[model samples]
Target chain A: MADIVTTANLQEPDAFYADLVAAHDGLSKDESDAYNARLILLMANQIGDHVILKKLLQEAQRTSRKA
Target chain B: MTKLFEAPLYPYKRCADQGAGKPVRHPVIVIGAGPVGLAMAIDLAQADIPVVVLDDNEKVSTGSRAICFSKRTLEILDRLGCGDEMVRKGVVWNAGRVFFGDRQVYDFNLLPEEGHKRPAFINLQQYYCELYLVERIRALQVAGKPVELRGGNKVVGLERRDDHTALTVRTMEGDYDLEADWLIACDGAGSPARRMLGLEFQGRVFEDNFLIADVIMKADFPTERWFWFDPPFNRDQSALLHKQPDGVWRIDLQLGWHIDKEEEKKPENVIPRLKQMLGEGVDFDLEWVSVYSFQCCRMEKFRHGRVIFAGDSAHQVSPFGARGANSGFQDVDNLGWKLKLILSGKAPETLIESYDFERERAADENILQSTRSTDFITPKSEISRIFRDAVLDLSEHHAFARPMVNSGRLSVPATYDGSPLNGPDASGLPARTRPGSPPVDAPINGTWLLDAMGHDFMLLGLGIEVPPLTELLGLPVKGITLSGEEIGPDLRTRYLGEAGEAVYLIRPDQHVAARWRKLDWTEITGALSVALGREGEI
Candidate 1:
């Protein structure tokens, strides 16, 4: 079984956040949600390891609206 | 000190045409002697076409209006024989600092590259631009070029004849009738000629006012554009500060949609606001003050029969991006060559449609850019302001957000990407100097490449052998060759790219008509025909 390395691993956190936000400019609520959905499918293709990909999806799903 | 702009540069004098009982048809008559009109006349006159300029006023424009001129404008003026003088009198600046609510965000340099002849932008008063152009006209007249400037000559009525445009000139003497084979209306924003012709502008109007205050001050502020959004002094409004020549600083503060124009413009109210923005200790004397609203609009078409419109007569934009006058210079540049070619019978009358096609595209580009910048500066809705503030907030910390912040998108010449005149753009050449784009200036041999071209068709061969062809297809096309040491990094990167050798067909207006990897005679003639508005005629 493979493990997902998820210990605050962004080299440029502020830069990434700004890019994420900037890409959503002029987009409505539904458009932004659809864009995120598309982004997920694209990212899944890059991390093609099945076990790590499953672990990442479970981790993201475990986080509810509260956190 | 008395200024050049204060005295009458081209005072009115009664002309033979005004009093000659029977109207004599001129080759070209330009209405309004403002920057656009003067430059238009000079261009036509340089092409050996006699042009007469008529104006309602005898003096240069009063205030420092349209102060920011781009490098493209300078290059165009250089073609008109007065670029060096304008650059000498103007304050050159390229860097701008942006602040969000009193905290400094990021600064930007407009041109970070070298080997270019002119700077990115210059803050010169509009009056000086008019003065320089009028001086050039005087010199052209001395040398006996067919150019005339008749000031205090107002054009009130315009009528289109079967083959020419007739006009009524109203002066102190009396009303006189005149005619023109080609009439150019550069009357200004409130163009009487456009009104007479029943043309109108179509675009959006922003609900905001700006208080422009030009003051003479000795301050420590560097000569850079400084813009603040929602600053403490102007709470919820934006303010801009720029330094000009001779210790003159221009300041503009945004006022909300609903406000009394008269009440806000009073000296007592204006000074206190200045004090708040620039601490109470700064000593400054007001030079010029005015209030204006921003509008981004243009006419449906620029060319109308024998009568054509240029500059403010055809379009007007918010003064945010300096697109107003810079684009006006471009209009003159694009129209002058086409008119000269048409008048000389080198190209057909259909070539005028290409002018309308290309410049109309350019005007759309300017309007689109100006409108975008205006929306970013002045948010129209609640959600818009929130998003703007959020971007400003993130811009300070993240380098990626810096490019997203919009103070103003400064003017650059438009490339007619899909223009009707653009011919075959061979692959593997530099994209910057592709077909329908203006030639990028680079140091070639000992002088600038732009200084060597223009005035006629040119075949530029870089790192390739060019046959000496004086005329091709009965049109004057001069071929010049450069190779070896002449193809430096700057020139190679701009013109050759990785192709190692390229030949370009340059229009009289210094735009690339077509480009190829090597000089092939068949391709050359085909491209030249297409460039002259004769498609597949070869």
Candidate 2:
């Protein structure tokens, strides 16, 4: 029997990242940045934690500005 | 004296026949306890309107018929205080896959737009959704804001009197007469209420038949929907495989054009077909198998006198795009607020006519789109087959194949253009920033209109000045004032990109009813009166 996985099982950051990469057929450098941005948003939506989502968005903006 | 009628499933214990006892009256009486009817009751009750829901069925149906809820539906449910619970139980599907024969033709992801609170789609059984809603209704009933549910109490006859509708309901134990200000029919396709009204249900009915088999499988299938054209097992037939919650899977197989309905029900012939499509080694037991004929039809009119139709009672669409239930929910969403407005005496009687016009148009559009999708998915004639094959063949080599292969338009939101309630488009706004496009959140110069609020008439203006617009019109308005410093880069970009103005008025159903860079009382009041169906407005 195939393993029965729930959303809870897929909630881990590592697992979520792995699934994202797999879904898009691996991540290039440019794709990785976009993927990270999308990942933060998806996590924020699922978690319903707007504070974390806002903080992550701010951090990404800061990093982009610095670069 | 003996009771006139009685039934075990009747939620109420009263046993009295029509003309045998005193009459009972309610503000609104709804038929069917399905998702649509329940949604209507919830909306009306929340607005402090008294309602009574009647269903022939004794209990909630066990199986999941429609499992997909769009983001708009979620917003409506959210207003009823059950959106979070639904989101928690349901699986969010952001991606979909299409298959041409055995080869994967196209795959697309539904990227969640910024500022939208809900995802593109959520998958949960309709039965569970109904159960959750019923529980909420029960709790409200316990708290004194009651919505009476009469299960197994079927409406035997309906009479629309001058001021009210008289319903003759029959339970196992007895019969009773009930009167209500308005009647809404949410019964299934074979709606007795709709039939009583003698409304014409006209549309195309496909000759092809399909067998739906629900199975408990242990195979490793992707969570995305899979459609196979001319699958390996049956070259002439098409098959669809979709994932459900738990270990369940739904498989739809075309049973060919010349299938004998009676013979197809036999398990002997059915098991072999199932095994052939699933392959030899797959171990899965079928829980249920049923055959269904596809039909695309809609009522000529959604409303007649005090009687209104919703859900399957209003229209029926092929299952190819899952448009039936989704469109039904949209109907309730459109009708709910209108009913609330009319019942509250905030709008004129003509406002109710808009509900009929808008929902009939919506149902027709849904049936048309669903028919087009079914034609694309399952081509009937030889010419259609050749065209379908050619399209798939072209998809393999062409760069534009992605859009051709993708069924994204199936899930697209219904656009409200040519609607009587709509206002003239302002010229200065960017072409893409028109109504029905994505909404942007900007600083509240007075009140802010957010797209996250789902379908509703929203007036956003500069603070106290906007109060006159609502006070005079008796309409709800939100005020927002934006300071230069408060606007962030991303927010500013979206606002400028989408709205192209500082202030705008949105419709109840989220189409831009009217918009202005600044509030003009003359234009605003005129638009309000037109939307409310008052004379000499615009």
Candidate 3:
């Protein structure tokens, strides 16, 4: 298990949310789901540590289920 | 005051042998007197073949167009005998800074670790490059080499016959008949030759306009590239500033798709834009201004019978990455040697087809890169703009996303990896200077390896002494020994590491045609024949 490190994260949270929403501007529900899957894989590759990535993935899945 | 280069018009001489009675056949006739045509003429003349050049305009380019000369372009120009002058007269730069709204995001140095000669990029006006080439041509002429320049001679009609290419050239005096063994069309993007032949220029046109201005001011701006995406002054638009020689700065501002062209180019409209960018009290003289749209297009094939197209005549790309002229120089570099070999009866005419194959690959690459840079610079949709800006923002803090910021992916030489001219790579060898790759510069004794070779087929011996009697199937091959002290350890690691006595058969354009672990005559001759289009699998 790994702890999530957060420092100076999302200073402009509104702008980041705007960008995140705008990324799926024209995509349908299926396409947006596919886009999110692909984005997760891309970010996983960037975050090469498997233990940390798995922890982050579990946290994200937990938070998303609550939402 | 800025120094401006004036193009000296060469006197048109009427050859008595080429009078109006009958058409006289020339060995080679290069259409257009721009960089590509002049470079081709110089290469042919240097190879001891007589060449004549024809151009409609009596001078160099009207303005400072195509300012970025890459290292590969400089290397090719060095072969043409005018590189030192261009380097001396140009401003060399390698570091580039990218900005997003006034704050600097990231910066990159192209050649951070350098041992070789020539910088990554040199910012010189195109007119000065042409002038240096013209001076070299004149020097070759003074030395009694046959290189004829016919300025104000426009090629109107072109007929590609099976035997040769016949041309109806239009001169100020009158129209004259001329024929050539090979006719090279370098008449630029709006090529009349390509249009006359009904060749289709096909590709994507970026729907954005750029206002390019050359302003002469003695400012203390460093010789580094500055690119901004949505700067404070420009406000949500991309802008680029590059320093050129003679106290001139090239400023490119993205002026979306729709705008009055004449209105955007006026001094009144242009001056306010300059004042906003360069602050107040900066007395600057406007050298030139032009509004241009981006297009990446090319002909289906570069070779058409005896008529071959080179440079912008064959392909055109956006000016973002400086691919338009640098790639044109590569075209000339690739074509010059092959054409000379064909004309001198050393190789078969089929060898010229490789030029079409290789240069089309290069053009496709340039078009792809320029299109990506253009797309990144001026994104089409709102989502794209969001991603681009986000990438820039992330690049400011994160090192991982820094590579996403594309401010004109600068030009580099294209390696012909899958070229038919390449032979199999030996086992346990480094892959930097492999077959189809350009020769990596290494100092041997006193002179550089590139300056030493390129006259003919050269057999470079690495890590071992070269043997004599180097006649490869009745073709003379010059053998040179490399001790690998010039480029230091990099050369040893790249060229010769445990591969005892490696031999490379280099082409006339200084590209590695084939390489072998041992000096085998049969393998050498087989690869050489394939390279010359003689026989075997190509």
Q: State which candidate has the highest DockQ.
A: 3
- Which candidate order results from sorting by DockQ in descending order? 3, 1, 2
Which of the CAPRI classes, incorrect, acceptable, medium or high, describes model 3?
A: incorrect
The estimated TM-scores of all candidates read 0.88, 0.78, 0.87
Task: Put the candidates in lDDT order, highest first.
Answer: 1, 3, 2
What are the candidates' individual DockQ scores?
Answer: 0.06, 0.01, 0.08
Taken over the whole model, the C-alpha lDDT of each candidate is 0.85, 0.68, 0.81
- Local accuracy of candidate 3 as per-residue lDDT tens digits, B1-538: 4334454456566655347599989988999899898998998898788999999877887678889998889999998998899999999887778888878888877664454567777899888988888889999999999998888788889888887888898876788889998889999988998988788887656556789899988567677788888887677678988998878899998887778989989999998988877778887888899988755788888888888899999998878788988998989988888887787777888988888878899888888898888788877776676667667766787776676778777888888888876765777666878888877776566667777776678888786566543776556788887654543565566677666557888887888888887778788888888888777543
TM-score of only chain B in every candidate structure? 0.97, 0.87, 0.94
Docking outcome class, model 1: incorrect
Tell how far residue B282 is off in model 1, in angstroms.
1.0
Q: For candidate 2, lDDT tens digit of each residue in B41-75?
A: 88778777888888877666555667778776776
Q: Which stretches of candidate 1 lie over 4 Å from their true place?
A: A1-67, B205-207, B536-538
Native contacts present in candidate 3, fraction = 0.00
Q: List candidate 3 segments past 4 Å from native.
A: A1-45, A48-67, B1-7, B11-18, B205-208, B232-236, B484-487, B497-501
Clashing pairs in 3: none
Return the DockQ of model 2.
Answer: 0.01
